[model samples]
Target: MAKGYWITFYRSISDPGALAAYAKLAGPAITANGGRFLARGTAAKAYEQGIAQRATVTEFDSLEQAIAAHESAAYQEALKALGSACERDVRIVEGLG
Candidate 1:
């Protein structure tokens, strides 16, 4: 099966509480759309080489499904809740097998 991944880049978080609120909604939205997180954490490498920021990777059964989740109303609402919280860079990549 082809898996899909969402690689996210974020700027230094100023409000962790807001992020937590976003995550609370985001987690369930993704699960409802058939996706799960692969990795989530601060950018540890920044300490050594000036990293871009934090990141979270979410995976789904297919790239189409991943994109669908991002466009879903529930996820869109979560994004709106997070929009003011942090700067973000996100992309969806297809996994090999």
Candidate 2:
């Protein structure tokens, strides 16, 4: 099966402290569910209409595992901690075999 990836792009972060807290909790939760952080940081550059944003990419063994991680209680706690700290987009995509 193709691997799965959780892709997140933060358009804006209003609360640094909240974001920090979320990161602390979310990172571990993700790893606990067999997710690996491939990238986490600001974009190197933006081209055309692309908007520069903080982005994170996490890989998982499969789509089911990725979905499970997102639905887990630990990640839900992280989401609670995050609240409205940022405006972002999150997606789970299957990788090429």
Candidate 3:
């Protein structure tokens, strides 16, 4: 099956503490649900329309798995901690292969 990926782009951060708190909770929650982080942190550079800000890429077994992980109760808790901390864009996509 094609892999699933969560692509997250941070538009802006309003609270570092909230992000830290969320990260502390989100990491384990994601991993426990079969998510593996592939890349994270701020971009080294942007090309064309790219936004060189904080971002992450997480992989999962399938698209449904990725969606489930995001919608899980644990992740929801993390989201609560992250409430309004930053503007972000999250996309769940199926792998080409």
lDDT winner: 3
**Candidates 1 and 2 compared by lDDT, better number:** 2
- After TM-score superposition, what is the CA distance of residue 95 in candidate 1 from its true location, in Å? 1.4
Per-model TM-score versus the true fold: 0.84, 0.96, 0.96
Which has the higher lDDT value, candidate number 1 or candidate number 3? 3
- Local accuracy by lDDT, each model: 0.85, 0.95, 0.96
Please write out the lDDT profile of model 3 over residues 21-86, one tens digit for every residue. Answer: 999999999999999999999999988877888999999999999999999999999999999999
What lDDT, from 0 to 1, does candidate 2 have? 0.95
Candidate 3 structure lDDT: 0.96
The Cα error of candidate 3 at residue 4, in Å, is 0.3
lDDT score at residue 45, model 2, on the 0-100 scale: 91
Instruction: Judge candidate 2 at residue 23 and give its lDDT.
Output: 95
